[model samples]
Target: MNVAQVRRTSGESIHFDVVENFSPFELGTESFSFSAPVHVQLQVINTNKAVLVSGTIETELKVICGRCLEPFDYPLNLPYQDEWAFPAQATEELLESALLLEKDEVDISQRIFEQLVLALPMKFVCSEECQGLCLTCGANLNQTKCSCKEEVIDPRFAALAKWQAND
Candidate 1:
């Protein structure tokens, strides 16, 4: 993005509408792919000391269910807000969280990538009632019930169970 215009005067602002495609990306151990093009609508404002960029990123993602391990579509509408401080006004706190605008042009690709990563959830479930998989036969319980008999007690606790029953 070209910040030359907005940086020329305080209170000056610009609006941007961007539509682009991104390849599959990984967040920790999970991987995600975009099912649709990413759409971004943003406004950039010059506040003399800093430039404020706020926007929304919309997309549909193909994700795997953490429980059932099935593929599903997850829609994302993420809000993004960040600041770029002028060299003279840059403070320690701002410098740690934001980037310095030393030049007329700024590349926001890194910011966008960070936003996507931060928006990811720790776990993904297809539904609340998902039965997950059978431990003995490794079968999807949601689809079918396995013939293996379930033992509710841990093998290590079997001796304790008998002692408690006697008491």
Candidate 2:
């Protein structure tokens, strides 16, 4: 991202539409792979003191379903926003907390990566109707039916079950 135009004149803005292919990244034990390049539509605005970058990002990721443990494609579309102080106004604290616009061009790949990671869901499921795996046989219920009988009773609450049955 080149901010020279915006930096030269306060209130000046520039719009960009780009597609980039980023390297794969991991979150804990889960690995995220991109099926295609990420699409970004962004605007850079000079606010006198700081430059604001706001945009929409879209991509398709290959992820394992948290329930079925099967690989599937997940489409993601999200909004992103960030600000960086101009070099003259960039204080020590601002530099540490955010970013400083020092050069004519800025490599926002890191920022985009952070946004994608932050927007990830806690659990990735193929669908809401996903049946998941069978607890007893470790069989994927979505693909096939399991013959293992479900014993849902808790041993600690066995007495309560018997008491309720008597009533």
Candidate 3:
């Protein structure tokens, strides 16, 4: 959504309610996708040379579990606040962090998408105690166990196993 800087007069605020459906935005890896429509309610307050933008974004994300590699739905309700400075009043350093008002308007869709990306969890898991698949037999450990005996031993740790046997 685009917000016109000129429309927000001094001491006046404008509110917007936007519903946007993205065509499966990629999240992190190609295996995960977010195909939900986002609902945003934004408020822009003009303080003469600067604008304060605050809003809330709500959506359901379809993400792959990093642990079990399962697909699941994750709900998101993110709140964001940002400042926009008019080009004439902004410094070079401030422009890096704050959005710059160019041609009397600012597009906020990109900013919203960026916020959503930042808000995503560092690790995606189906559950806290989820048992991931077995590395040897490729069996879902959460559902069933395999008869494969995993006897992996590092070359450096081979001597340690002999010491334990003597005890």
Candidate 4:
């Protein structure tokens, strides 16, 4: 079951269980994992050509931290709601497919996955106070301190330091 089927609620008020093992994003990515599963319950309403999709997906996601470039795991509770149009003239077979957009077939799961992928913070700091890697030695500050002096200021500004002493 995909997002489109899940979003399709009958006239009498329908509910669907949405499921997808892999969202197609992990196919060629180096840092993302395909082992995690995605599942959700969608409640939808279709009025004319308009379809409303609302659901919550709770699953485990594996991604490499943008900061340390190390893979990490996170539990996701992704709430999704979107309105789309699959024309009344559209083939019934196509309308039932997941992520079906307007005149053409567009999978909602793909876009939703894109949203989930893009929504992730570009920089994932291990903690709020993460000191990050040492600029000079490329040492992970969270694990160890670098022997290189941090106060090695540029020589061009050396004269500025002595001005404070004279004042």
**Please, what are the lDDT tens digits per residue for candidate 4 over residues 114-160?**
65776666555556676676777777777788888567677766777
State the displacement of the C-alpha of residue 39, model 3, in Å, after optimal TM-score superposition: 1.5
Top TM-score hit: 2
Q: Candidate 2: where is the Cα deviation over 4 Å?
A: 91-97, 150-167
- Give TM-scores for every candidate, taking all chains together and pairing residue i with residue i: 0.79, 0.84, 0.76, 0.61
How many clashes would you count in candidate 2?
A: 0
* Structure candidate 4, residue pairs in collision: 99-106, 99-107, 99-108
Cα RMSDs, all models: 3.2, 3.1, 3.4, 6.1
Please provide, for model 1 over 1-167, each residue's C-alpha lDDT reduced to its tens digit, 9 standing for 90 to 100.
78899988899999989888888987776678989888888899999889999999888889988888998888889998988999999999889987898988888867787788788788878899999987777789899988774664687699888999999
lDDT of 3 by residue, 2-121 (tens): 556434568878888989885566654554455578899989888877787898999888877777788888888999899888777798887887877765556777888889889988
Quick one: how many clashes does candidate 1 have?
0
RMSD of candidate 2 to the truth, in angstroms, is 3.1
- What 10-residue stretch in candidate 4 is worst by lDDT? 5-14
lDDT for 151 (candidate 4): 71
Which is the leading candidate under lDDT? 2
Model 2 TM-score, all chains together? 0.84
Measured on C-alpha atoms, candidate 2 has an lDDT of: 0.89
